[model samples]
Target: MDLAGMERSSLVKYLVRQLEHFFPDGQHDLSFRIEKDLDQALARLEVCIDAVKIWRKGEFDYLHSSQYTIFLYFLSNTIWRSRQDKRLCTKLFYLNKALNGIDCFYEIEMPDIFFIGHSVGIVLAKADYANYLVLYQNSTVGKNHGIAPKLEEGVIMYPNTAIIGDCHVKARSVIAQGVSVINKDTMPNSYVFQSNSGALEFKPCSKNILGDIFRHV
Candidate 1:
């Protein structure tokens, strides 16, 4: 897909271009880096689909909501996370920019609807999770004193749980589930997880959701 466009809303185009800068469009350029990124992107897409399902069943007509369209477009990129796979990566970049504009101008905060393992055993807070941040089952990023991390692009959280703090989970980091983070900084592309005890103590996403609003959602 064309990641950049003209007469397609200059502001949106600009944003898309900026986001596209994170990727270099080739395995040679980003060689061994595609697998994990693909996983993260896919994880995000899963949550996005759940959000859409919920939005569709809402009181207001979610179809007419621009937020809804932007969401679909943004999430449509997951299928292309393959390394050097220009197809989906490029599309993802395009959709990301448009979704961003909707978020900026429309004030539409994307919902945080995860799949836990298949969307289970995952841990997350109710705070607004931006588009495309996926968490594997057993992974946790609940609120600490009501503060949770706002994940950016391509963030795939692995199972076993590993996220905490009033920090921005910068784009593209794989938090190996079961890891603990508090008062710490996680840079993009790095990996993090709780110690052995931390991972074991953490419960699966299903266990946490069995009879809660989370499960129902």
Candidate 2:
């Protein structure tokens, strides 16, 4: 994959510089392990980028906020999985949050083929996320009473939507904008909307909503 105008080494340096700039306490200096694991993270990112219809298949632009947000999540998650270094992971997590306004921790296991429509105001908790999960701005997937939601494949959470607490979001289910699904279950291939009575209403949808955003949906 092409890293816009930067080489792999330059990208690594850039990430380290950002981390240092954000966390200048001298206790969060990144080790050489980041360089070693960067390739794996980029490889994972490539798979996701290639699946996206709008993004170029083989190019990655660091200046793009949404792309950078996903890349940071991948890098931080990769480092956490490979090295288990909390200090470096914390620094990367904080850097991502500061830059993207998203609260995705390094320890959370995100799917390999998910897409973030907008980086700001998105919070993801420790939920069971499947591939082809699409998240938009101000969307949240959080836990309530220690129970998180299970987002199946091809699930799309539109802008300002949320799925909280023991929700079994079935495949091909689209959560409509500004809707909050709390402790609820959605049928497969359905659209979740909020009625005037403040209750969730499921409507059968035959259209492939994820097909517009993802390839081979």
Lowest lDDT 10-residue stretch of candidate 2: 24-33
Best by TM-score: 2
lDDT per model vs. reference: 0.44, 0.90
lDDT of 1 by residue, 73-143 (tens): 33333333233455545554444444432111112233445322333343345444653455554566656
Off by over 4 Å in 2: 27-31
Clashes of each: 20, 0
Give stretches of model 1 more than 4 Å off.
Answer: 1-117, 193-217
TM-score of every model versus the real structure: 0.37, 0.96
Model 2 clash tally, residue pairs: 0
Residue 169 in model 1: shift from native, Å?
Answer: 1.0
